[model samples]
Target chain A: MRPGHEEIKDKLPEYISTGNIPDDVKEHLRSCDKCSQEAFLLQELNKVQVPEPGGLFFETLPQKVRASVRQKKKGFLFRFVPVFTLIALVVVTGYIYHTITPPLTEEELFTDPFAIQVFDLSGLSEDDIPPISVDIADDEIYLTEETSLYREFASLSSEEMEDLYEALEIKNRNGGVL
Target chain B: MDVKQTRYAEDLRLIEKYLGGDEYAVEELVMKYQRKVYSLAYRMTGDIEDSKDVTQKTFLQVFANIRGFRKKSSFYTWLYRIAMNTCLNHLKKKGNDTLELNESIAGSNGNALPALIKEERSSFIRGSLKKLPDRQKTAVTLRAYEELSLKETAEVMKCSEGAVKAHYHNGMKRLKEILSASADSPGRKGEGI
Candidate 1:
């Protein structure tokens, strides 16, 4: 075989089919028995019969393809919808956690420091307490105010109180008040 | 219009319908290309059920991303690319050791097919095919058996034309060697499983 026989032999089928074979390559096929055999072998290999695929191979494929597409699309939104829902749920949970929680009471806020102050060691005696004056005149004004409702009520007789109560009860028993 | 032009137009119409919210158009597109997609996947993967899975996966991906298609290539070209990718990805996930078939897989049917001899030869060819490197195998299956043009194969492969040429060359060369060697070997029967 020639030095470049492999390259020419590789292209032999294509060139022969296209009818543009050069003379030098033709001479190579003629002179090199090995190259000739390779070309012949390729032709024979091409002739090796490949049978049509068994079953309704072609006819069933389209339905299978459609079913597959439908299957994918069926879950297209389902795939991401849950993720969004989870995110929203997390955010709402966090918000409610912050907003609905009660504020700390003053006692609760000062518990640590106030605990020390609450157990005071200091005790004061009653003798150390300051004296305070009573204003009896101010207290007397309530009794002396002649036109006040309190004074008038205080002046009411026991019999007058019973008569007033009886009149009020009579008005209450009347369902015609409206 | 010519058949080529008509196919393109029809593909465009279906795509428009799908984009306009007619999901049934996706079914139409599937009906149009499912056989081609499945056959390509089956040829590349060499497994009937696996190829069906790949075909289903490819169409799902297609409709999922169909709106992104810019009509730069024919719809079939785009569909073929998705189908090829799905098959190759499926192959990768199954791993490189998966290239060799296991015993349980071959006898899996327990002689389900009526024509045992023909099934055996078919299995032999598939086993030999898996021995090719993935890209080369893809190129050989698409071009030789699937009858895709070099351009279409390149498009499906998402590679330069020269790369397709090289892949097909190396692939065909290796296939010839493998086929010839298998033919000469008495032990070839076990290789199918």
Candidate 2:
């Protein structure tokens, strides 16, 4: 109720605990009803007793706690099961995407000139191309110089080479056009 | 080591054992502090059932977050902190429920008349406590009910010692007023004297 009453009340518990109330606080408590009541209430609040649960409560509390903890752990795992499954599905899908054989793009086909390229035969007639048969017994037709195909072409006369080059140019043009 | 240091050591040992997968360590830890936690909860909730529930929830939380117990404060202080928070939340959930005099006085061990009288007084005290603001109730609960030192109360409360003093002083003032009002008002059940 006074300017210093709050300070005294704050110190009251400490004073009571140590059994060393300062003379000023003691004097104040003697005169101040508010502070006296506060002190008495604090003492009573501390002294008020609560009933203890029976021995069975204490005996069974741990088991109850343990059961609850175990239930919680199970709940945690259950809660995350779907998340783990989702992650696994994503990873498996990624691996499958990378592992599957992919269709060759035109760029890939063009990058390697010698690589096999699929032709659209739907527009071409069989009679549009001529085929010749080779005699397996012709020894002179064999590749005598195995090192280079160019060496065999080098042996051709200028006129023959000119005709062969023209034939190759025509084949390339037809392949692209078709 | 002093007695407190020894307690800290034992608590740490049990915590370590619990964390290390010793199942019985949990039982040991629970047994050690259940009474104190229940006592604090009983004061805050003023009912035996709510007290039991709060005490169990406190331990459940403590064990669940045991890995986060940084040992910055003693295990006892940390336990009180969890118990206090649980009590506050439980009280909020209860939301202005008044204490039943008969239920509040159930735990007496002796002569009926004196015990009933004491319980009546206690019931009035708990009713008065419920009227306090959360912080003031907490301050009084820690200082008066749990018997924590101001510093320990501050640690459990996560506040400065000055703040605890302020809350506690205000709480005591309010309690005196409430008790006085109860005494004067004949409609009020207990004298709280």
Candidate 3:
């Protein structure tokens, strides 16, 4: 409870072990009953004898430790192998599923069944439909010639147009025979 | 580097080698620190067999967790920390079934009498030490017996130096009281140091 007894008490363990206290602290310890008692008890505690293991114990300990750890390592694998296998199985299953099953496109998702029935009735498979190319050049819509039956019709001469109209008239009169 | 730092560096190298699959490094490391770890474990448990178990567990734990041992603290301090934890856990689970003093003390080769006396003194001291709380017991063990510096003790105990001082001081007072009480009791006086 003196001005420096607290400090001396803090250093008492070191002092007890090695007698490394400063002279002033030693003086404080000498004068302070509580600090001196603490020092004594710590010194006594420091004298406690732990039984030493025999020479063979030290000599064989590393081997024992390594063997135990190796055993545990095997046990660790034993415990986790199933979990790892399950994880790998799940991953492989997921990869196969993704590899074989393509994702649906927007057109596939929203295709009309009625339109498909109409195409079936027309006896025209989807592959029979010409692919259309639209150009928006010069602020005007232009359908490519390959995709445009209207462009072919417009390119026909007047005599060929008359012949085609007469043939379509005769087929119409015969109830859509053409 | 100083001797301590040099040892730390050597310990780190051995640890790296062990981690790199060199089994001989394990032997080297265990050979290097087994005695120190055993001594601490003995003090903590107050029984030789328990100390051995604790020492084995400590090394196993150190090897098991060695990869996580960032070189932030000295390898010695980290080892002490693991050893201390292993000792505490061993005592916690085993409940400190210290051997009987008569059965525990082994006779030395040359002089039986001084050896017996020293063993008896040690037994009394360990009994008193067992009476202290865990933290206090650890503080006293590390600071007083192990001869670690206060800073090193704090690092091992994973507390500040101030807390180490407080725990050690309180432990000393409590130890003195225990010794005094034991000394005052009949038939226990001559056995004490």
Candidate 4:
């Protein structure tokens, strides 16, 4: 047996159809009845004609297929319309809500936690405001002590007056004796 | 790969489109293979209307089962396999269940006639071919009549390349025997294969 006969026999059908036999396969096919017989039959099969249909027989197939698909989609679209409408309604409602709603005021946005709203004083004149009172006597705080302290202490309580009288008496006595 | 080879890639792209719900892709798919499918059918069934029927069945199968097609082979290969099955079913339904040979005589290579005689010869060959085993007939029809490559024939036949070749070999051998036996004499009732 030739070294390549097995391969050739294995590939004989392809070799016969394509006429591109390997050299070893070719050598083997000459002596091999089985392989040669295959080659001959394959060759004859080549003579069979591929028949062509007359006119435009196949031209309408695309339309037919398209029509069928269209029918299916139309059925689907009936189901599709309600879902599509629902989605559209939701989206439109969301957009309206975002557009029509009022915005937050600056005060409401940036309010201070420690601050309170008070009446304005920038519009008031001095005469429109009351004076602030000081608890000190005028002579002491404004008169430079030239005024008599005895007159100011005349309304003092008994103990304080007594102490003031004593201090005054001591001062007078020390002045006269000295 | 040759010019015809590039069409496979294009077919894959269209199939992707078809799967993606482009109706146009369906139309395009039908447009691409309709004629070839019809022609293969016409040749296989030997009737124009029957060819149309099988072609319709073939594409219908493509439409229905396209989602399940794994892209393991090119779309045409799978389509033709479906076409081949449909054709075989048709032939089977028509009860051409065996190779009942009808002998047809011929003029040898030197004396073969032209025109009308050629048509006669072609018809005779087709007629005689029906007598082959179903598998051999399918292999030859795909490989020879359709001129599909062995690989494509294997895909269409849903068999290995080796198996396809074996079917082709047996078919070719049987075809030769039948043709030769018929060619032994013209205008005579031939023996059954």
Candidate 5:
């Protein structure tokens, strides 16, 4: 049967601690078989003591095991330190390399005199010259058209061109703008 | 100093020394709190061996992470939190089912009936505790066994006082039911309830 007399039955443990049980509830507990049995059971349950673990148990943990555990922990740390250091070094080195290298400039690619020849075509338009088809065959210059000037110019090396320019400088002194 | 006062003073000194980076302070700290930690672990795990393992692991974790422990909480509270978590994780890994209570004490089975009954009850309580939801078990253990106040239990549980109260009430009610069932069982008659 549900104890409809009071809600204090549900809170019996708390009320028991404070010794403030109402007279009606106290009378119910004193007379009611079920509630009294439950109260006795709770009292017995409360008195159940947990056994303390043996005193010597903790003391019995071998010193060697403790040392080994300590050693294993130290070993893990020691093993990690060098790997961490290497990673840090690689990252720093990569950062420094990236920061120090300069970018490529356009002047570096275009400044070589050998890479281009400037033609004095001040009075010439794109249509004045015959279309000359030049082919490099067997490491020798080949022109599809048999032109004397083309043969002469192609036969001279870059050093020979410098020599011709020097000779033309002397000739230009004798005859200006020739 | 009186024995209790001297021990308290020593615990404080050890805490200060640990903060000061003395290596032995950790050892002293472990020595001081091992029983409390082990008992808590054992009560939570329901196995002496598992409790010992959990206790060791808890101390090692505490030692490693002590630097992160702010002084806002008491050292014991922080330590208990670590121990509780470690025990819970261990229980979870083992599948959080009911653990069998050992029939023999220290490999012997000739103890008195009342003592055996009490032992069985204690083991039942420990097993029942595992069956509880994590927060409820923690709140119940901290309040009942550790005798921490509701406020202190809340602080350790990282919950509001009302939550702790609810957990405690529900946990105790469940425990009473479990114990009552076990007491009425025919197999437990030898336990002399």
Candidate 6:
């Protein structure tokens, strides 16, 4: 009676490792010529050793192979440096943009356009005018009585007032006002 | 001192030096393992020239990627993995069936059997190994020749232990059949089992 094929194949490594063949398996191996031959072949094959590539092997290797190898290694890093540098450059540019550029506020945006509005005297009448002498100091601005005739100049629109203010050298004391 | 012990100590020291940025350490490493790496390459590719190329490429890869090595595996095992990968890639590029038996085995003189056969049964075993499939060949070579444990072989081969076992068993079985048949060929006399 032959041992099953799967059983024999599975147990073969165990047998080879331990050299402990079971009684029935051994009997079956002996009787079944194919299995017996396979066993013999396995035993013979085990005797084979792996051959060394032999000494003096490295002597035959390419001369200064290490130099070429190191060069190739450097080549790999060199290839990636440009890409890494580009990435770093982009990141730094982004950081600088974020840090140096001030954030725009809603108040600044709205107030900047209306800056001239502060100089408007639209609701003031002649009676509402305080004596110019009271507000103007002589050292800052000489408000001569003759210049008081120009006080009604406030009735002009801002564009017209800007034109007249630039025409006179009188240092339009309140020219900056809207 | 035992050769393996002396070599192992030297290798460890060189690896330490290499990690420390000693450029010469790479050369020392190449010198130490070049033969083993070349032999593995030859076995995997069955071409002496290709094996040399593979060995060189393997060392290059090892040195280039050394920083990534976590020391979880032995240096030789790591080197073997590189050599195997290099050879496999070469084989794949060249097509697996393009494996020429005569390339590695042939010498200046006609099929140099005497030189190859003198190494007891090892040459015969190596010859038989060439007949197995590529994966089986790799598994058997690592397991039997490299003397790696089943687990280590599996790790190197990137397969399960059961898969390694299957490749190993099938490889051994094929080698047995081939060796037996070759031994019994017409020109050869029936030899001792």
lDDT of each: 0.69, 0.78, 0.75, 0.71, 0.65, 0.66
Largest TM-score belongs to which candidate? 3
Q: Per-residue lDDT tens digits of candidate 2, residues A1-178?
A: 4428767766667666455677788889889876766566666776678888765888899999988887887898899999999999999999997679575679988897876756678987878755434445545455566734767777899999899888888888999432
Candidate 1's C-alpha runs over 4 A off are A1-61, A77-178, B98-122, B183-186, B189-193
Q: What share of the true interface contacts does candidate 1 keep?
A: 0.28
**Worst ten-residue run, lDDT, model 1 chain B?**
B106-115
Mark the regions of model 2 whose C-alpha exceeds 4 Å error after superposition: A1-37, A74-178, B97-120, B189-193
What's the TM-score of each model vs. the native?
0.56, 0.62, 0.63, 0.57, 0.53, 0.52
Candidate 2 chain A, run of 10 with poorest lDDT: A131-140
Off by over 4 Å in 5: A1-56, A60-178, B1-12, B98-122, B125-127, B182-193
lDDT of 4 by residue, A1-178 (tens): 5556566655555566566777777777778776665565555556656666656666777888778767866886798899999999999999998789665455854586654445469999988887645566555555445445555666589998888778888889899442
- Order the candidate numbers by TM-score, best to worst: 3, 2, 4, 1, 5, 6
TM-score: which is higher, 3 or 6?
Answer: 3
- Candidate 2 residue A20 Cα shift, in angstroms, is 10
Report chain B TM per candidate. Answer: 0.83, 0.83, 0.84, 0.82, 0.76, 0.73
Deviation of model 6 at B19, angstroms? 2.6
Give fnat for candidates 1, 2 and onward, in order. Answer: 0.28, 0.49, 0.65, 0.46, 0.05, 0.20
- Interface C-alpha RMSD per candidate, 1 decimal: 6.7, 4.4, 4.3, 4.4, 6.1, 6.3
Q: Give a tens-digit lDDT track for model 3, residues B139-188.
A: 98998877688899999999999999889877665655545544444577
lDDT of 1: 0.69
Candidate 5 whole-model C-alpha lDDT, 0 to 1: 0.65
Question: What interface RMSD, in Å and to 1 decimal, does model 1 have?
Answer: 6.7
What tens digits encode model 1's per-residue C-alpha lDDT throughout B3-120? 6679999999999987887777877888887777777777677777888778778888998898788898888888888888898899889775444323233213212222232324
Highest lDDT against the true fold, candidate:
2
